[model samples]
Target: MKHLKKKKKLLTNDTFVIVPFYNEGKVLINVIKKLKNSFKNIICVDDGSNNKNQIGKHKLGVFLIKHPINLGQGAALQTGINYAIKKKAKTIVTFDADGQHSAKDAIEMIKLLKKNDLDLVQGSRFYKKQNNNIPFIRKLILRVATIIANFFDNTQFTDTHNGLRVFNLNFAKKINIKNNRMSHPHDINKLVSKYNFKFSEYPTNIKYTHYSLSKGQKNLNAINILFDILISQLIKK
Candidate 1:
């Protein structure tokens, strides 16, 4: 089993974990607690969550940003990234607020980023399946999407839409993310290839709970994603 090497030096003070949230009140608190010790800063962007009342007044020493309107996940993520940059973060790790990802795994991704000097380190679920309960339909969509992304963008990532990723501050700053919708992952992949940034993939475990599966993007969203990619390409052309 491959594991991310632990960095000899502690994570830089400029490293931050960015989590985009939307009505994930039940899980967010625990996620925050789990990750608080690993990174210097934790930025949680609440994307106009309807269940904000449920979140309560909990200050875990991490910065929380709120949006008045329900923006898409992509917008929330971008908001967090911008906040991290403003805070002078040198590295940003994009994490999920739904409790699907483990904080330890996030730390590993950071270590991998430092070890390989990679612009981005993406977590790949396809590398191993140890009690991972990924839905069949979602798995198939990801497989097809990964193939299309690799072929069209000349990239070889096993998991194209994994939210767990670490980005170097310099390369991340160059990314002009215009997609304010669910297709942002596709846009990011395209940008990585276009900029000729060094990217690597590492295995990470994703626990697919029923709540997460139901709340996740449906198969129909793939059409919108494809359309977004095409529109982006045409605009570039």
Candidate 2:
């Protein structure tokens, strides 16, 4: 009981940074360390990682949760959300584990959420202006996705697939991520309308590293996501 209490006290954080990772051992610990500077409560959901031992070894004030198998990124994120809610977290931020996202963007997003008393804040790579370093193919994917997403929701966001988002506890309760894969982006964007969350997208400087670029979705994956959406719609019938 004493040990559990100590762990809880040490792990308790007002700002919970929830990260869903799958075979990202190379960058997971580093990502947590970077967030440690800005956030106190950190939760890393291991999505059936082969390196479960590896993640367990890193005790940097992170509450590590493990999935028995590779469910999906969306599942991992949802698991983290559940844990964060149970812990009574005041704020929750979803961060990418591949390190494509910037900690500065997360800090600014959370700050804006608190200052403006907004329920949700999303990141946009193309908001304001985009960097030339963005690959042409990657840029095209985001643009097309953004266009399709715009048709689904009234939210005027320049980037639709961005993973960096901050949610207040109240707003987080309203968010129920059902997608078990990358389709989570669409699932979340569509929910804003249903809940009427006071949401807005802010400019975030995204850094596409070689590793992230290599691990990123392909054009073929886009077709699969479209198919998935269509199937989901059909299922609703």
Candidate 3:
């Protein structure tokens, strides 16, 4: 608690937030609203949504960037990060547009990043929190996925797929999220391991509302995510 105060004093200023959404209209707005209270600079990237309605239209003090065609979440994040870098942002945050993520947790993640002078801070919902609300099948999939990630990537994180993260410009500039969709998280881990970036995985909480759960990755989709990662690496080779 005391440490958070010290970190927040420095991090709350000039912090850039990147929110990527695809057709998450109203939920995106509310989530951004909550974030505005925590940071001054916020950017929302519309990831080529098919919906006719626009997002953050009347929301003041928020930067809105949109892609013409549907790109993956990774591309949307890259777009926002590029803009933040151009604007001379020292630190940037990647947040999910869905209501699953909490602004309070984001504050802590950013603070820890600055407090430890780390390159990246990742939020892990499974760190210490009970997965009571998590569906049984979902819980099994995530735990297995975490084990696989740690085994192969050599990362010791408890949660691998949480969308909340903080990165200093040095690391942010080095990021290239080519996987685009759900596979982006895996690609980011590869980059982190490859670059040997200073990072931490902190315990965080998530709200598994029906809406958020519905938008979440299906259990069967893990197979597809694995295939995509393999194919991308194969292409690089």
Candidate 4:
């Protein structure tokens, strides 16, 4: 009875949801509210946003960590991860603040992690039943990016850049993100390959709204990210 109660408690608590945001306005609050329904601990890492007032109002049951300067998503995620570790979070979930990711997916991923006794569960938009709303150009870019990441990282991943992920503390302690920007996804993949963590992909839903699309990465930026990864690889070589 005690073990069952503890297991149920672990599912409801002992999980921290890390949300890294730049300039997301009220969308972030809504995301937090939705996540609160399933998760008790929520960490919001503000990566030096100009509009700080938007998230400043919500503090109940949420940890808001502010970066003095814009360090990028990787840095923000690292900050949140470190905080969660200090809090002794049994499981850590990385979620996007643009309102594109689904909180239900996150909950499901966490449950999958505990149930399967896996180290990590990555969300994939193209894994099973694909989301048709993905912009054709964006989908092409992601497909190309996944191929490149797989070839270099020597691992098969359906979606290389999906933000929704859940991992246990063992994997969390092994993570050290060097790249602080867009190239961080590649860095994470490299780490996963290097450490050989027990992981799997879960089909997730991506809600693409006009606002999210506007905030999405541009074609030129994608090119720059590729260039950045190429240079980083060269430097390592």
TM-scores for all candidates: the values are: 0.89, 0.90, 0.90, 0.92
RMSD of 1: 3.4
lDDT of 4 by residue, 1-237 (tens): 975664456456578999999988888889888887667889999999987546556765788899999999989999999999999988999999989999778877887998999998989989986865998988989889889888888889999888889999998998887778877778776767899888989999999999888886775677877887787888974
Residues 1-237 of candidate 3: C-alpha lDDT, one tens digit per residue: 986565556445468999988888677778877887677788888888888535536545788888999898889999999999998998898998888888888888877888899998988878767554778888888888878766566777888888898889999888888888887877677667888999998776778888888877778988877777677766884
Angstrom error at residue 4, model 3: 13
The candidate 3 region of ten consecutive residues with least summed lDDT is 52-61
**Candidate 3 accuracy as lDDT:** 0.81
Using lDDT as the measure, the top candidate is: 4
Q: Could you tell me the lDDT of residue 106 within candidate 3?
A: 80
Best by TM-score: 4
**Predicted candidate 1 versus true structure: per-residue lDDT over 1-237, tens digit per residue:** 133223323345788888998888667788888887666588888999887534347767778889999878889988898888888988889998878888888887887888889999888898655446677888889888888777777788888888899998887787656777887877677767788998888788887887777777788888888887778767874
**Candidate 1, run of 10 with poorest lDDT:** 1-10
Q: Candidate 2: deviation at residue 135, Å? A: 0.9
Off by over 4 Å in 2: 1-12
Where model 3 places Cα greater than 4 Å from the true spot, the runs are: 1-13, 54-56
- How much does each candidate deviate from the true structure in C-alpha RMSD? 3.4, 5.4, 2.6, 2.8
lDDT of 4: 0.85
Checking candidate 1 for backbone clashes, the offending pairs are none
lDDT of 2: 0.79
